[model samples]
Target: MAAPPGCFVGWQPLLLLAVLVVLQGQQLRADFGLPTAVMGGNLVVRDANGINGVLNAMDRAFRRFNPTGQTDRLMQASAVISQIALNVTELGRSVAGSVIKAASDRSTPVDELFAKLQEKYGRMSRYLDSEVQNAIETLNKSIGSAQSLSLKNALNSVAAAVRQITNSTADVGSVIARIHETTSGNTIFKAVDKASIPADLTTSLSRALSNTKDQLTGLSRTIEGMLKNIGTTNAFLARFDQTRQATEKNIVGNQQGVKAFIDGEKDTTVKRYTNTRNAIIADISNAVGKLNVFGTNQTLLALYDKHSEEYTKIYYYLFNRNESDIQNISSAFDAIGHNMEKIVVDSTRSVNSEICYNKYSGQVINTFPGYQNGVVNCMTREKNRLGRITDVMDRMLQLILSTSQDLANNVASCTVWNGFDKSETVYRQAEACLHTNINEMAKFGSIIGRELDLVQTLGDVEVAASRYRLYDCVAARNNEALATIYVLNKDIDGCVSEPGLQRDVLGGGEKGGDEDTEDPYEAGASTTEEPVYDEYLMEVFSNSSSFGDDVDKIM
Candidate 1:
């Protein structure tokens, strides 16, 4: 057969034909050793009979077995094989690029995580508002209750005083005239008539009324002074309001500042961090995108180097090149692959190192909203205490006003030293004077009784203390003198002992052995002992005797 157009013939074609035949069989099992199995699978070797099957089909087309015809047939087979290798290389690049692009995509998870963080921040703001409202409500309730109780107490005190005064004034005439003369007047009103009594008796009665009036005036002045000093409790409330307002402003400002800081952190720091991480992921995706090109170039370089020389000698192989060209091609492909791989590996490391999940672990800043509540609680407690104090001052003012007004009314009606021409009015004034004297004297007697009881208790305490080994002798002597003085002051002539000993001593001392008719004085005195009166004791007795004589003279 004659050589066809644009064809060449030589021993190189024969050897090339034999080499292609051998290579086709091995190419069916060739492993390109790609970095990714996905790209490798797209290569022709993945098929069991990709190269060999095609060659066999081409071989079957050559029925005329002659040298010239065989050379033409071998050349046609190489062209077909080259075309198939190029197509498979393109397919592998496309498939590998798609896989890497899919693997490197991370925008979805990033968006979802950012949205979740934003929701948490929103919930934090809501929680602060709810907490503040609850605290304020509780504070208001506490202050309100305190104010109510204070007002109630003041009103109840005023009501009690008014009721007492009303009962006392119900029957003035009977109240003034009613008197039980069961015992002698011991202190003030010994007799009703000034002519029948000592001058001192009248003087004492006048002094009593003057003193009562003076006490009322003094109390009124004191209340007026307090009312003037405090003026109104509004100042306290104003100051408290100022303090509360300042506290609230500070608390609100702090809460807002903390919230703003968190919001700023999310916007600036957290956003920047997320953006940086996402950028790294994008870079890795770009590197992965380049991996397909590098893989395709490597495959093409190997194929061109292996078959270019043979294709050039056999027939019209347009891609014929030198050994250095093939080596440069391989080197370029290797460099690109190395760089892309490095970018992929390094960018992947960066993505892996990113703190995407739970970025704000324990990052919440405590604004101490409870500190504001504590301030409120303390302020409210102080306000409540101040309110109570104001209530007490108001009650005192009420008492002084009411009592002074009543006294003024009484004094106006019961005028002092009106002429005899006043008739019944003069008599009524005299009666009021006598009644006041009697009331004052009765009060004095009760006071003296209480004083005596107190002294008795003191003496008993001292006497019981004498039983102790450490009791001072001087104190015991003083206590014994006090006891004797108390007995004598009570008009008991004999020394007394403990009540139990008194019962034992007086058991058979009753008249005709009748216990019911026992004398109270003898029963009270456990033993009737004659006291050895010292000088101080005698002086006390003489003063007491003088006191009694003065009382008798006044009567």
Candidate 2:
């Protein structure tokens, strides 16, 4: 007697048996190492035939469904469908993973197969007789549902449009009513005697009344037509109320979201930047103070004094009785003054006499070869040097005196009086005062920047809220219209499936049956015939496995 067709004999059975044994071991481990040898034996006896039968049935079904002549086409189609399903599943999984990652630091992998099932087959497929056929049916149903939703949405949209028209009409009516009330209340019309009224005025008033009456009549007709088309005004109002409620809810939610986002940004990013800016300002203030101290250092003051003395001597030599020396010195003095003017202007300071003297003294010492040569020209080098020095000294002294006079004038003319102090002390106090003012300005700038940022954030929030409110109304109306469209599509689909349309398309009875009997797959049979799968699957599977391993290690 021959063994049953599905009975496994060699390494195949052994491999299956090994897998079963491993599963049994896992089960035993799960059960706290309970003695499961007898249970394993029972599993083998109970499941072996059923497993073999299922495998055989799968093979037979594949052979029947996928014939040799059409294997490639069917396989390619299946692969494409599977690929699409996988891609959709992966997209859903990624979305879910992103949501989860945002909520928690953990990465969770959703089952691709489950996601595919949900996306392709839907919940109704599980109860259907054939999963594939039910999948098709579910697709049809979903299309129907979508169509119904679209029809409903369209109706709602029309209703909304009608409501808008009605509102416009009401507004026009209110305007007309106001005009009528105003005209009726006017005492001029009542006081004017019919016989005594000017003919031109009476004619003008009658013409205006006629025009107004004509406009009101046209408006009334238009309102009546709109009301008839969109059902009663009361019905439109009821639908508008529903739409308004939905819109309000959506607007509130969006407003809250915008508020939360603004609050979070202000607390985190804005505040951090503000603090950093404040700290920078404080550091800058300290740096400015250090610069002021350096500017007034003893070494700097000594350098300035030497330069001043040289400048004073040069000035005295230029203005003395020697004619030849006077011309040369005057030209040098002018050049030095020009250069000093340039420096003071470049530094954004006024051309005060003290600044002029100091700057000219430095420039003369640096630029004049004659001053150095004269130092060596005299019989006694001391005399020539003394002469050069005295010339600079006289110029500097004149500049200093001029500067002093200006300062004294300014001080004496001032309304606010403080105790008298030395010039050096006053200069230091002025430097400190300038530094304080600069610090205050920087602080004010930082405060203003922060205030502007706050105002901008508030404006952004308000804009977002306003946009949300407007779009919410549009969305609510659109959703309702979508629902109406869905109903209309259902009606159309039902009409198509009815006996009349079905007979036209599918040949329900005997007429034109030959056309319907022809095979749909006949034309393409010769061109396509080979086992095929999507090339991308192998790569995807490898990548997925690697990713899974990495995740497992991390967990």
Candidate 3:
């Protein structure tokens, strides 16, 4: 008559109910204790008086009726069932009255047992529901605390970066304002005042100005030292011009015949003329070399080293006082661009050579516009300088050959006529034009040498000014980047503000219109333009072609 371990002989309902209650209690224990298994969210309530406990007490009462299977024993089972029914009412009130009424209607052991287990399952579900609620509350609190700490740390990082950027901006503004103050009537200075400048900016400005002044003074000293060399070169060329004219008249005027004069002048007048020509060439070469801009351009230097013995050879340059010589020298002058390439390289290095924005690659990209613009200004100034030099050189070449036309026509008959009278006429015209050409060349070369020195000095100034402007430009860029970061930390869509970042960096530069901006070298057009020679020297030669066939062969 006894029930099985998990089932009963005729007590199926009670046995099934007890087993299900135990199984459900274990599941509730797992659910309620899940927080402890992971991060320990501190859920306090456990399965102490849950439905499993109530069922255990009911099982004991059922066993008491096991020995006496009589009608009176049904009262004992009912009493035990009523106790469970009360527990269900308190825990799950909705099913309390229904469970009790269903048990009373059947009054049989199996029917009452089924109603009891149903009520116990409901009680256990309610207990788990309460515990699960507590666990969720604890989990929410933990998540909130963690999120707050993360947000705070993020804000702190952005705050620190913002503070650094703000200080840098102040230092940069102060430096620019100080520059403006000293540059009274200067383009940028006119727009800013001391009242608008921050106190910290003044200190940085003072240091920058002091350093700039020192650099400028050093340049001034360098120029002052070069002035003596320039004077020496000018004096040498002046004396060489007078000596060349005297030598030409004495030697070429006394030739006897065409063949004897050519043979005789080769060792005397031609040798002296070759020496004077080479000397002027050396002077111009040395003047350009002293600049140290381009170390040594061999191709340009080769034009000056023609031998006196090979004076009439077409292969040589200065020996041919013909159109070919003009072309050769022009090619050499064109090669001056190779020398000026150094100015471009040096100016680019000066503006953006150092790695200032190491933190971000994008910031490095931001510096390129400034570097490019600076180089453009430098090359423009240098290009104009080259134009002026060539302009004066062009005028010199035109002046030197201005009187060659009449001589060419007069000598046209000499080539046909063959005598001392014909030879002397050709020789005199050739000698006169050659002497005048050499004198004028020496004078013009001296002027170009002086102009080259001025151009080099102005090029140095352009590089320095570009470097200063680039410093300001990059500082503005870095500051703007930091400010954008600060805004991004606080806002989700911070990228919207980044489009104008580079624009803001170049804002200060836009203030300097083409005129003010183009002249960062501080040398205006009128300042760098080549000056005219004295009227008497400029008008010394007639606008006639005098480089006749005899003049070409004599050279």
Tell me the alpha-carbon RMSD of every candidate: 68.9, 44.0, 38.8
Give the poorly placed runs of model 1, Cα more than 4 Å off.
1-194, 236-262, 294-555
Q: What is the lDDT of candidate 2?
A: 0.29
Q: Residue-wise lDDT of candidate 3 within 137-243, one digit each (tens)?
A: 33223212222232223223323322332343245434433443465333332223323434444343233323322332332222222222223323332343344
Model 3 stretches with alpha carbons more than 4 Å out: 1-339, 347-368, 410-555
Number of the candidate with higher TM-score, 1 or 3: 1
Q: What is the C-alpha lDDT of each candidate?
A: 0.29, 0.29, 0.31
**Local accuracy of candidate 1 as per-residue lDDT tens digits, 1-555:** 878876766676889887876665344222111112222222212221232333233233222222232223223322332332233233223322322332232233323332333343233234322422443233223222222232223323323332332232222112222221221232222224112323332233233323322332332232222222121222332333344355446534543443343334223422332333234234323322322221223432332232323222212211222233234323322322232222222212211110000111111001113334432333233223322322332343344334334332432332342432356665455445434533432343244334323433433333222212111221233234334333443452211211222111111222323332223334344635322222111110011111100000000
List the lowest-lDDT window of 10 residues for candidate 3.
546-555
Query: CA shift at 363, candidate 1, in angstroms?
Result: 42
